[model samples]
Target: MSVQLVANVLIGIALVVFLGYRQATWRYLDPTRIWRTPLIMAIVGVVVLAQTTTTITTTDVVFLGIEALITVGVGLTMGSITRFRTVATPDSKGRTIQSRTGLLGAALWIVLIAVRVGLDVVGGHLGAHLLTSTGTILLVLALNRAARAVVIDQRIPRDDREARGMMVR
Candidate 1:
């Protein structure tokens, strides 16, 4: 395998491990802060896309579209299964809502990774190489996280949303 591809695989695995842990642990669900990760991932993905020399083809487009759909679907599923409850913040007497994916959420992440890998195998055979690029992977991850954030935000009470400095949709 090429060095770049190897590096991408390592980075992708690291991200999965880190993000999976974060999602599986109970953390304060601040609507305002939850979107940051997705936004940052998207920006980085765009930057990587700009720097890459890969030629995009129709096959790449089709595969990426399908992958994006699957990513978002899995993310939404994770959000729906997430456990949320009010809890006292470590440093504060007041209670704020916290969320965790626990086991099921983590399992969904594994499913997403499996799906992405399966798609990569098919796309590679079909010469849809962009599916294997770092940019594409990051973009797919951002879409998944964004979809999950949307579902989580929706579950938050309007009062809690506004109190946490998030505009209610």
Candidate 2:
């Protein structure tokens, strides 16, 4: 078997494990606080992108950069939507609007990929993908933390009131 095949298999296994872990944790453990969904998706995207690598070119780098920018804009929009929904209509129906945090997370992953491609295009002066991935991972971690802080600080009281059957009016 080729090294690429081996890497692909490993990545697949890792994704499976991550999914299992997420499902189990959400179902039986702590559903409210588990924030691994974004990180997991990011890892899966990176793995898929890495596995499909042909000869890298400037065009590829530019395309990746454009895609990354678009994804980030989408993610920011999603985050705003989530914040709006969570704030403006808290208890209308929990199942109505989809959460946008996942989109933001996916965008972060794309940003990492774009950074990697950029580094490669710049003659690989750095560790390319590894560094880019690490930086984006850190950014994601910070974003998640900030988001949780905002939710905890702002949303909890509203949620509690709604749970107590108190109408906001």
Candidate 3:
């Protein structure tokens, strides 16, 4: 009913979807751990909903739309990342690019954030708030990328000299 309630619900749904994808796609994820995702989502949703006021603007709607597009792009990118192949036989190439998916995904996310912030600026907000919000988005993206990189790297084991046909001695 309220704008804050809507935003919180949307964000909560997004978190649940993200967690479901992680659980289904990652072999390491435990089935028991899956419940934690929605629980966390609910907790976050309540907190956010409690803090937010009900007012919203046209720009806010546009921002949410852009974010939805970004979410879809990221999901596709994750699927692509999981399907990439890096080996043309262990003996052939020294090393290969595991996946360009993460980079592509990150780029798409950055573009979405940039467009949203740019629109905010163009729409109004000609003050410190605009710059602060933009900077915050960039920082969040950077941290997200870092976290994703760590997870992905852990999922795929790297072939060392011994594994790739070089003698250890």
Better of 1 and 3 by lDDT: 1
Which candidate ranks first by lDDT, i.e. highest? Answer: 1
Q: Give lDDT per model, in order.
A: 0.83, 0.40, 0.41
Between prediction 1 and prediction 2, the one with superior TM-score is 1
- In angstroms, give how far residue 22 of model 2 lies from its true place: 16
Residues 1-169, model 3: lDDT tens digits: 6564365346435633553444243233222222343344445445543554544555655554554455445544543454334445433433442333434454554454565456546544632222223223333333333344334434444443222211122
Q: List model 1 lDDT by residue over 1-169, tens digit each.
A: 8987898889889998998898779887767677888899999999998888989999999999999999999999987887777764532634377788887887888889999999999999999999888888899999999988888877774445443534365
Give per-model TM-scores: 0.91, 0.34, 0.35
Better of 2 and 3 by TM-score: 3
Candidate 3 ranges beyond 4 A from true positions: 1-46, 84-100, 123-169
Model 1 alpha-carbon miss at residue 43, Å: 0.2
In model 3, the Cα lDDT at residue 39 comes to 41
For residues 1-169, what per-residue lDDT tens digits would candidate 2 score against the true structure?
Answer: 6575466446435643543343232121112333454555556556654654455556545544554455455444433433322334433444222233344444444454455345445533522333223333334333443344333333333434432211123
Candidates ranked, most accurate by lDDT first: 1, 3, 2
